[model samples]
Target: MNTDYTAQEIQDLVSEVLETADENGVLPIVQLGHPVLRQRATAYNGQLPTQMLEELLEAMRQTMYDAPGVGLAAPQVGIPLQIAVLEDLYPIPESSALEREREPLEYFEIFNPSFVATSDRQAEFFEGCLSFDGFQGVVTRPADITASFEDREGKEQSRSFSGWQARIVQHETDHLFGTVYVDKVETRSLINESELWHHDDLDVATARRVLNF
Candidate 1:
């Protein structure tokens, strides 16, 4: 996919993907090796008709929920546009939730989103990507952030997020810039999905020692 697109080109691209969707309307997620995932996404600029964009967002929302992931970006679905959908409905143990400072986030879509770290504080946690299923690594990121983005109706919105929500924002926005969690992950902390359980209950210091990161 190209880094930039004309309005008509955007419409055509979305139309083609929607038309080719399976019976469940789930778009195929591009993997790590896909060229589209490495390209910076084109910013939204009324390129797609409102209705068409809505359809695309809905499809992406469905795809994200189907993958059981907290977020999904346009590039992940081979659409090189600065759009992403996010939500976290999965239940977790109270202890784990408090440890990660994680909370449930309602579903929302962001277009051309950007953010900045709000403080010097950092947090490290195991992160996974739908693009590379069954793999995870410990990534350190700012614990607080302020983000700005256009909503589905093209309204500009700005908000502050902390903890897991902030991580979700940064992770999804990074995709628009062609960055992935693995790029910032501790190499020694990379592990297979099944091994996550072994380290999941460990404290950060213990995990670091065990993983030798």
Candidate 2:
């Protein structure tokens, strides 16, 4: 990637962001604290070509994979758009032998998604974010949510999400509005922003070289 920026780059970035947001399934997300994150952009055109949609989906999938996270927001990488990419985690049978017992960590690559309606039920989860860096928080959300999303081409699709899956969608969506998980933290006990990132947290570094390498 070319990291260089020109005075005219803003227009290009914005143009690329919109075009990429339309073509790349999960184009790179801007990190938190980016100024444009808080502003809501226009919704999708709803009638883009299908081939363009597929490329967008593939780009999104690659974005999530490269970021090394279960989900990503359009704004998190630098683009200010109404989109995100995530892998679904809820429907998996917990009893499956391959299932990992821990936090909800399914993968997703969603675009222009909406929480159609949320269930009355709600729960709190210890959540983390790529943008916030090291802070974790307790965010309360519906136990289940029926969400609708468009495919890469802007076609309409929907799904019922509950448990961990519902929580993930709710969390990433907040990113579109410039909100971080830290904003939803209910109790100070569940979070430690000051200690979010520390060398001691890395097992390999601590055991191998205490010299702060």
Candidate 3:
């Protein structure tokens, strides 16, 4: 059956699916048109049950892994809490010329995160989000950042990140502030994921050459 849903209907349907996610499994990821994806998420006040928070974070991690994305935010899953999970555990290959300096990032979670630019230097890269499926956009962000956030147990954790790791954290943190990569991308730089991937050219130079970004 073919059905055309209005934006509000789609948003409501996404919320319903998230609300009914398996108790110990992946949650539905809300897409671009949902209002929840556009709202600034509320800060975590350490009031929710610790057990519940644990399960949610675990489910978020599982969802992120299933989507095979570098990060996932609570808002993307239809939760307005200030929480996100990210990991870039594998190294960039030597063939990725622009990212050879990047290092592997261990799994981490952040709540109510905030960041400060450690350098005035800026860098541009293509980024994709679970919420903005099937498209990638070019965004320029500070080359280095230091961020602070609460851990799962309500303990404070502060860290500095650079290279791809810095990009991952900044992208996820922006979600908490109601900002998506589309909002900051160069208009001419958006490319469908299929055209950008599924080819031998995976470096910045090749991307700019072919996509004209």
Candidate 4:
């Protein structure tokens, strides 16, 4: 978040960063240091009317698209709601290798997902969280998980995830509980936001210029 350049230049640069990221990959959002990261988000109190839920979902979608990250949590953006958004990052086999280069990002808002089961198989996945700001770490996690939660409207739902998707769901669910990715990692060997590279480029959008959305 530090830059010595002009405020006007920084503002213009922020615009480009948002634009570049949304079209290439989901933006990695502002993480834990911003105060919202530490607060345990409140679960939906059955207060949101149907329209409100829809509006909330739309805003989350746009925010996710803007931050250009594959996923985002409600608390990260200052919302205390227990809601969380996740877009699947798995690529389809039919997609070209180039297309597959960026992980598939699909949206899901799990109202209050609880882990039903965790696989015994352990695997290490390098993970990044919007709440963690600029840090990345290698974390060992269960390879599969079955979880249940409510959707945006509080309807009951359940799903099982394997591999990377399972990891993402677990990571985001942790955010709702006010947990950062660093908590899961064995070591705090930090990878600051500036140090991250998406698709081999530190500036994810600049490296992935051709992605239309």
The lDDT leader among the candidates is 1
Candidate 4 stretches greater than 4 Å from native: 1-30, 89-105, 193-213
Least accurate stretch of 10 residues (summed lDDT) in model 2? 204-213
Q: Comparing candidate 3 with candidate 4, which one achieves the higher TM-score? A: 3
Per-residue lDDT tens digits for candidate 3, residues 168-208, read 99999999988999999977778888877786646666767
TM-score of each: 0.95, 0.64, 0.86, 0.68
> Residue 164's C-alpha lDDT in candidate 3?
77
lDDT of 1 by residue, 20-65 (tens): 7778888888899998788889988888887898899889998998
Rank ordering of all candidates by TM-score, starting from the highest? 1, 3, 4, 2
The digit string of per-residue lDDT tens for model 2 on 18-111 reads 4654333445555566675666633444333455445544665677666556677766757555677787444444442132222455555566
Query: Any runs in candidate 1 off by more than 4 Å, and if so which?
Result: 198-203
Cα TM-score of candidate 2 = 0.64
lDDT values for all models: 0.89, 0.59, 0.80, 0.62
Runs off by more than 4 Å, candidate 3: 1-19, 22-24, 97-100
After superposition on all C-alphas, the RMSD of every candidate to the true structure, in Å, is 1.4, 9.0, 6.2, 11.4
